[model samples]
Target: MLAGKRVLLIIGGGIAAYKSLELIRLLQKAGASVVPVLTRAGSEFVTPLSVSALAGHKVYQDLFDLTDEAEMGHIQLSRAADLLVVAPATADLMAKMAGGRADDLASTLLLATDKRVLAAPAMNVRMWEHPATQRNLATVLADGVRVVGPNAGEMACGEFGPGRMAEPAEIVAAVEAALGAGPLAGRHVLVTSGPTHEPIDPVRYIANRSSGAQGTAIAAALRDLGARVTFVTGPAVVPPPAGVAVVRVETAAQMLAAVEAALPADAAVMAAAVADWRVANAGAQKMKKDGSGRAPALEFAENPDILATVSRGALRPRLVVGFAAETEAVVDHATAKRLRKGCDWIVANDVSPATGIMGGAENAVTVISERGAEVWPRMAKDAVARRLAQKIAEALQ
Candidate 1:
């Protein structure tokens, strides 16, 4: 989507400034011309040489460079690019932008830009959630600036929450959305991922070892294709991607409700590892031993079948995709599951512990549809997601 377009990327100060290098590469690889603008604080984490090397363009940093001003004035520079992006849009930078500060080259260009601006914020979780930052964010948003993510996850400060910068792929997707029309443009997709916890008590629960990497990848992939994605996710180890509406749930029941609420989607992908059963009589308080020399005998009740329910619902999505995790006869099981669940397609993978795919980074999956099954070679989860998302684009078309 970025082919032949020019992007004025302003790198901001933050640990995530390093990710801008990769973002530049992804942009260029997609045939976009990248113009580098590195801030003074941004240079603290990444060198000008490295930024210049990756972007294949000279780094512009000084606000008053005589040669630069003589050739391309700051205002002209802003007008030249098709889009302006700020990765690692730190709290300070964003605050300044909200206040229309043009104190330096980066801020000056941002102030001068007549084009749409996208910012991917990165900061400490507390700072990100702070009232001042929120006010500034609202200010920028009101200024017609678009925001990607300060996704939830582990941060550089050893704290875990919603402060991490969106991944390079995710930011690239947002950039594409800002710049041109994508394959899934104007489409809405709903994706469920991660493992649901069937609580036995406040302190313990039942859950599978699903890291939600595949689902996260899939959501990112769909977004990259320009789909408006509603991601209904569980407690995933990997954080949710940017540029999508996320609904967090803990139980299968909650997931079902969230999915149903996010209906009217063009497509739906059910990839969560939902527990089949939840405790029938979950105790309000933690269970205690009474020195009876016996463990508690708990009863179980079937949890809502999210995939089947959504597939069979009156508001069924146009394309319903489910997942089948099997230890044996993966394709056959998924094929049967597709029919049984009334889904249009099924993605099957072996999670037999031996495969190490349950919580692993890479995956080997078989995509089963009504036409037949297609065996996908073992590869990184992101690649598989890209392929599946492409298939979805074709199917929807």
Candidate 2:
């Protein structure tokens, strides 16, 4: 997918900077020409000679090198690439990008580049989770920068959490997904996944059995098809897919807000298993049992119906799909739901205990549309997602 592409790769300072060498080799193997830019601190880990040798190009480092300035101006160098990638994007680098600081060659190129940028963050666990770093991340994301991972594992600091940079293969895959051309190219799709948690008290809440595997698969499939996806997900056991804009939320109301914020898409898939009701009279603290042995009175309120709202909203997409996980009469209930919710289609599955479909790897689904129901045989959720994504691509076309 990256054939004939020009990638301006900025190597950031971190132990993960060593991985950028492998990333350069992988990018070259994928048929992309890499222009290396090494940061001052980055040189401590990987030498510019090795980077330039692997990339087969001059490594750019100084912002005011007279020879570089005379040969090719910074503006041209920055704008010449199809995409800019920052491997091992340290917290400091990300903060600089967010704050628009251009004190160095790398940050200057990032600031001057008009092309899309992708970052593979690497930092300490505490640094990754810091509020300032998270704010900077959110800022960069809102500015259209794509992120791959700071996956969870043992860190070089002897700490374990989410701060490791993504593997070279994963970064390459994300680069391909970012630059790929396919049926859904230039399209934007919104997807919701997982189960919302309705807080009942400080220590307890109500949730469902949704693992978010199917929805994650669907988002990845859409991304592979070249669509820009906004994945609004609730508290899910399964992590979200790469190469998509992810918005995490805890409650149904928060999910609804996130969904609404990511509006005016070409298509929307409401795959979340939202709670039907929430505790209206939730306790400020954990509700304690009285000595009389009677439970406290709890008031219930209806949660927002995301599917129906998205389908009927003013900014509704051309195609709005919903999912129905029913225990009985799945097809009938799903068909009725499609009509009642005013959605274009409903992907329904029987999630009874006997089926073991919910939170399971496999799925047996029925697609309900205006024409009727089309039953599909049991298969892996990934397969289901690919088929459905193809259908969505066709519909959008």
What are the lDDT figures for the candidates, one per model? 0.89, 0.91
Candidate with the greatest lDDT versus the true structure: 2
Where model 1 places Cα greater than 4 Å from the true spot, the runs are 1-6, 9-64, 75-80, 85-175
Error of 2 at 199 (Å): 14
Query: How would you encode candidate 1's per-residue C-alpha lDDT over 1-397 as one tens digit per residue?
Result: 6788999999999999999999999999888999999999999999999999999999899999999999888999999999899998999999999999999999999898899898999999999989999889878877878777766678888998778898898788778876646778999999999999998988889898899999998997787678999999999997777667989999999999999999989999999999999999888899999999998889999999999999999999999999999999888888988999999999999989888898886789998987898899887686688779989989999
Please provide TM-scores, in order, for all candidate models, with all chains considered together.
Answer: 0.69, 0.61
lDDT of 1 at 296: 87
Root-mean-square deviation of every model: 7.8, 8.1
What is the Å distance of residue 116 in model 1 from its true position?
Answer: 6.9
The C-alpha local distance difference test score for the whole of candidate 1 amounts to 0.89
Candidate 1, poorest ten consecutive residues by summed lDDT: 173-182
